[model samples]
Target: MASTTQTKSNSGVEKHADINWDELGFDLVPADYMYVTKCGKEENFTNGNIIPYANIAISPFAGILNYGQGLLESLKAYRRDDGRVLLFRPEQNAQRMQIGAERLCMPSPSIEHFVEAVKQTVLANKHWVPPPGKGSLYVRPLLIGSGPVLSLVTAPEISFLIHACPVGNYHKGPINLLVEDKTHRATPGGTGDIKTITNYSPVYKAIAQAKARGFSDVLFLDAVTKKYIEEVSSCNIFIVKGNVISTPAICGTILPGITRKSIIEIALGFGYQVEERVIPLKDLFDVDEVFCTGTAVVVSPVASITYGDKRVEYKTGAETVSKKLYDMLTGIQTGRIEDKMGWTVEID
Candidate 1:
């Protein structure tokens, strides 16, 4: 638990909310404000406004509701000991959302527009940022087709909004995975690489089944061949053998994770040979370490993986590559270590 502080809001009102930062989980704890903007089919994104957090009104025939035409991004704001807030590679998320919007035939906010909206949202909810090393304010940016449409067609209007919540680790500890063979998350010619809401909802059943069997998450295989390792349900997978680290290549079937890309560069800086190729399920049995990386999970070690009736376990208590990477990444995030990579953006 961290001490409560009374902070003034944008409206000049003092807010004194007691928050248990250390006990925060990956749940949505509504903040004080959110940023919202909208655009028509031929118009660029307009200036956004910071509004009180509340439910939004939309038409029932909106493309987002009728056809699931939307994209979302997840990033975080970290509170440093010096009372500075930092955003971890927000431009990357902006670019990814642009790509997702293009894939869904929807217009997207420019990188500058997107980043500015996020900054405004975080600033409005600055008091909700957890204490340094305790947790972070999880920022979610969403773009949806807001125009009402009856036939299957591109949306005529779109809206973008940014909201945040204080969150801890998505998974509690080292997690166990179940290899999925029946349910496919994505395919070669599908919207797998994009962060669309439609891409996520279809996998709910598979994940529910995996959790029902007492596993932490589901590890998906390639949809077509079903022989190569693709990724976990929500994160990218990597395995370390000896001094080498390998992960599945981003070939339209895997979402390019910002944390995954950072870890690869960090590992290379540490003189570890990094390989991006097709990893087979059999390779996991011989790997010394396994882990998953994403915005929500950060870096989580995989304790064991069960494929069918056979289960393979790895070492994951303390001294491991995953732990080392997690420490380095979190250190850079919280300003405890020098950010030589220039990945963090400081917010005023």
Candidate 2:
């Protein structure tokens, strides 16, 4: 195995004490069980497992290792007030993984299969799902090539599996991002558009450099112009000016975040102007507000953004518009508000 990690548990099943979401920085809680499946030869997928959310098992010959062929998806399971668990628009994640699989010449899992896998996990481990506002289970679905081959060409054998963790938000404090104009996350015409493991290697240096310089994360710029803001290390960036909300348009280079789409639609539904257009890093300095969206942090504020030596700051909390959106989004997720869009699917 590349890195043998033992689960911090007994019987290989995680038996966590009722988690303290507030102390964990989690506004939500994690569910207990997880669903998984595997792909074998002959375009066949054998029955997977419904394992407890504790440890992971993988083969040393898993295609993700020697050749770097894999994709992953992340989503949350919200626990509603009526003692029900719901999932957001998980179809998008499945569709995205299908796209990634096709591009890598691997087999794709059926949407039905994907959704059922998720449902099984949430239903079995419903107790792990923290309260609506505390935190929720972080579901991760992984697809990797598993054929026993050492060739250089694309292989037909692959495996699709799912795992979960009771992670709180990535961080609770305000986020400070270092803008690395010279360090690019993904090159144009590269696998930047796909959620492949290979896309992460080139940005390790930029991440390390930013951490050493007192920044919590790195913001990548365009490889060519270096003026347009692409994305933060783990999330998509946003700009708010007065009543208008603007985000970087999708150009097949950055991760198409489900949370980003939800926030944009929510803004529009609130009668605010929302624009998905090309945004420059310079525009953020003059904007009324700045935020980042992802499955982890949901609606995290940008306290300060730093370029080579220049820095800009912002203010946001429960009173600001940023906080309003955060509350509304999380409220809808946790069942505080009515889910008019039918974005949530009850798991229990």
Candidate 3:
């Protein structure tokens, strides 16, 4: 944890939040401000600005409240050792938000607008960004249909906002996952590939049950075939067998995670044959290692996965491939190592 002494940032702002940095977790610890913008259903989003973080008023008939029309994107800003702040591939998040927006029948900010809003929001709450290695400032961008409507049509207005909070590891360490065979996360031609608000909460029942059984999360198989593995409730899954790395292909079923994409490129650069194809659940028992990737989980190794009466354990520790990937990824993200790929954008 960083010293609690008062300090100034490069932007002449407080260097840290008053809360105990050592106690940071994935939970929200509201920061000082957020970014917000609104647009009519017909107009494109033109601009947004920083605003004090607080509860947003929405009508009871708002589409987000009534029809669950919303999309969310997550990214993080890291305070480097030298006190510089960096964001990893925020444009990817922007592109993804546009994809989700189109699918949900809503207008989205362009990539430039999205990136600028994120930069402003992060710099505005620079103090909420934890000290080097302590944690990161988790930025959440939400695009919602905030307009009131009584019918089943798209709302008259849309909202795009970004909020952030300092966070520690989403999962404390290596996680245990339960294979949900009965309940499915998404069906064919559904909203699985996007980060829409509706794609999450339905799985809460399965996750709640898994947690009660002492598992960290739940993994869902493909809804149609129920044979191939899809992804976890939140992150994308990967399996390592010998020199090959494989993950479920994004066939409009699995969320195309930014971290998952970067990890694949990194693995290929390391001379590993990476595959995006159907991964049978049975392969879990034959794999040498298993790990998951996401904005929140990063690259968490799978300690154990339970399917039916069977359970398979994977390699975990500092010597694992996941650890190496995590190190390289975080190194590039935090400026501890040269970001040869130019994936990070520094906040001035």
Best by TM-score: 3
Q: Relative to the unseen true structure, what is the C-alpha lDDT of residue 225 in candidate 2, on a scale of 0 to 100?
A: 88
List per-prediction Cα lDDT, in the order shown. 0.89, 0.76, 0.92
Q: Runs in model 2 with CA error above 4 Å?
A: 1-17, 25-33, 41-47, 52-59
Residue pairs with backbone atoms closer than 3 Å in model 1 (clashes): none
> Model 2 over residues 176-197: C-alpha lDDT tens digits?
9998888777777877777787
> Candidate 1 residues 1-348, lDDT tens each?
223467654335444347877688987788878999899966789888999899999999999999998998999999887767899999999999999988888888999989888989988888888767788999999999988999998678899999888999899999999999999889999988999887788889999999999999999999888898999988999999999999999999999999999999888888889999999989988999999999999999999999999999998978898899988998888888899999998887
Cα-lDDT of candidate 3: 0.92
Off by over 4 Å in 3: 1-5, 8-13
Cand. 1 Cα-lDDT: 0.89
Count backbone overlaps in model 3.
Answer: 0
Per-residue lDDT, model 1, residue 235, is 96
The number of the candidate with the highest lDDT is 3
* Per-prediction TM-score to the true structure, in the order listed: 0.96, 0.88, 0.97
Model 2 vs. true fold: TM: 0.88
Rank list by TM-score = 3, 1, 2
Q: How many pairs collide in each candidate, listed in order?
A: 0, 17, 0
State the lDDT at 130 in candidate 1.
Answer: 79
